[model samples]
Target: MGYDVDCDKMKDECGVFGIWALGQSEEAANFTYLGLHALQHRGQESAGIVSTDGETLYVHRAMGLVADIFDAGVLAKLKGGAAVGHVRYSTTGGSHVKNAQPLAVQYAGGPIAVAHNGNLVNAEALRSELEAAGSIFTASTDTEVVVHLLARAHPAAAPGTVEHLVGSVRQALGRVSGAYSMLFLTPKAIVGARDPMGFRPLVLGRLKGNWVLASETTALDLIEAEYVREVEPGELVVLDASGLRSERLFPDRPPAPRLGRCVFEHIYFARPDSVLFGRSVYEVRQAFGTQLAKEHPVEADVVIPVPDSGVPAAIGFAETAGIPFAMGLVRSHYIGRTFIEPQQSIRHFGVKLKLNAVRGLLKGKRVVVVDDSVVRGTTSRKIVKMIRAAGATEVHLRISSPPTAWPCYYGIDTPTRQELIASTHSTAEIATYVTADSLGYLSLDGLYAAIGAERTGFCDACFSGQYLLEFPRRQNHAPLRLVGG
Candidate 1:
């Protein structure tokens, strides 16, 4: 099987977009398509859309890019006044057409569709329990467990009733654990829910007096929607003909004392233009760079980012350090999933295919490289060598985020702790491994300062090894130690 050549970085699970135009003549599916297109960076393996025309749900799902999977014909066929869409990169399920989402089904509560953007830590256990109770799942994704849960919740309620649907969603979500930012589309309404801890991002917006839900504000910008506000952690907002209404998933329990918003969203997953947790993602990234510069001051002739993800931080570092900033490396945007492996003689052919050093700008310069994070250190090593080959006199490495030492159980695709270089190696050792003259990572305190939030409000589990929820323990895998307790 061909693997992603650039697989060393962390990957988000998926992106979700939903729109409710109830009595309007808007093309909900088309708006959803545009929103998904803007969120395409969050997930690229597959895309799907489901819409309801008040009585029936229409779905078009395929294993490909959103643009490739949807066209005028497909959108026209998805006739509806409300719709939900998903772009997926599997974290809890195998990558295949069967797992493409906006999972639509008919149940005791009538036809409903779901688009989910996070992982359920207890999915295996839930799947087992459901199976023992005679639930037959068509897909292996953790998201399917949710559909079944909703299908079984409030079995006594009359089907097709709003009360039944709302009760089913609340009851179903209350039982699941771990990160989730979900959207449910029914004949009557579109509902958006966030996990109580708020490990994932979901936001609300307004487009022509209608309600729109998206994983990021960038999607809202693409659709020209007015930015409303973030869907509060633990809150459920239902959008329908009567308008938006809020409910608490756990009506009795108080909200989590410290919301566990994923810190990595601002660092890498979200588009720089997005507003996450009421902060501009671009501004936060730049602050991370500035903080990194304050913590690790290195004398260098020029500072260059790793491109795209690294740009904002690099700019911040350069401005704060008073060093010349340049695009010393140029990245190719067209590299696809498939590529023929070159002979072993072709050193670093994979990395070269995606990035090339600008010899004219980098040669003879004391180059400081800024990157978002280092995973296994293999890619960083290659990048370092590439810069050296371009005649950089000295290569200093600076990372915007602290070392990621633990695997994420909440939707991000990360390597096991054993595979993470930082999990076992120290900063000096990692510098030597990556062949950098020196290395620095933004301190945890500096990170929180840049975010302008209390550490208690966000989840830095990947860096601190403090998981908010207990995850399933599998044989042969070491038990994840949760430091939150």
Candidate 2:
């Protein structure tokens, strides 16, 4: 589902989960599995888990959904008291089993595993440097570069001590740059760290007497863990037998004027039930609808959401505009990755496979369709046509978020700027292309008001073209075949 050919939604980044359960090795794998299951919406291309007993590490990873990859038989084999897990969508690597994480490896110091949830802007440069110095890489993922750095870092303490592991991790991360919320599982502890800019989310929680770390609060909720606090940007937290302790990753650098938290999390990426960046996602989305309604008031018979993501916003829009809210379109949750297509006879069949218009609800109505975003505009155009065919007299499209004019380099997978319809066309031109009676996107200022936060603390580069960090220009490199395992 991560790489749906017919879907125009922005591709999600990866999700990371880690747990430190002292004297509970038997339950660690099970708990990690449930955590990953809750985070499945973030990524579905691959899943993995790496667990550690006091003396040994066990790993299992595959290219598939989390539920499909792990079973009773598989989880039973991953014996450990602490563990780290990952669900990946490959923002910087090829989609192969080798790229699936909790990338486990044996180095000079000992065994270590890491689960990463963000992209590294300097990965290619670091990889080139490592390769030049005689390091061999087994996977194409940016995560593998971190592992190599850890292997080469010189620790001042003894090889297997907690100090040794923490020192090594700090050294490794210091050399790399960009948006990363990572979990490292050493035999001695489970460690979590976020980038200095806070471009992604990583939270701390507790279950019974055990410690937990996840990319979002929803994963903690699913595991029945009590929500604790976020692992702050530029902070490194270590959880061992003695419990949790924290350290600053970049103490020397002056504090940034603003945190670079990804704004898309509140607008689209996160589940409605989740809390992200100290705000309730559902409430924020409803506020988005309210603000959108205030910005673009339309005279319509009914306001309908464009299925799952738009439901909250649409409800708020309807309430604010004094229009009735209805489910004019229904989405099919059971759509698979592949299906047979009628040869050259069906148009917009892909959209039809996933959504169906409610003829009775839309018939003879001036319907307003609300959606989270419009990516390439192909899906939106098809959906508008479908609504028209279902007897809607007038269709007005309202977007909950501002136009996505630029690609995301932090973690998300998005089309190039040239491919985005809003990058070149005005709102009126886009409305014409999509064949809607009217189109309105929430203003950038309205979005900030809805979130009840200052614009200084967020990375709205996709909307404002202001990136927190400078990324290297894209370069053509020869294909790298699988090297050594």
Judged by TM-score, which candidate is best?
A: 1
Q: How well does model 2 score by local distance difference test?
A: 0.90
TM-score of each: 0.98, 0.96
Query: Compared to the true structure, candidate 1 yields what TM-score?
Result: 0.98
Q: Supply candidate 2's per-residue lDDT for 183.
A: 94
Over the full model, what C-alpha lDDT does candidate 1 score relative to the true structure?
0.91
The positional error of residue 140 in candidate 1, measured at the CA in angstroms, is: 0.9
RMSD of 1: 1.4
Clash number for each model: 0, 0
- How far residue 319's Cα lies from its native spot in candidate 1, in Å, is 0.9
* Candidate 2, residue 137: lDDT: 92
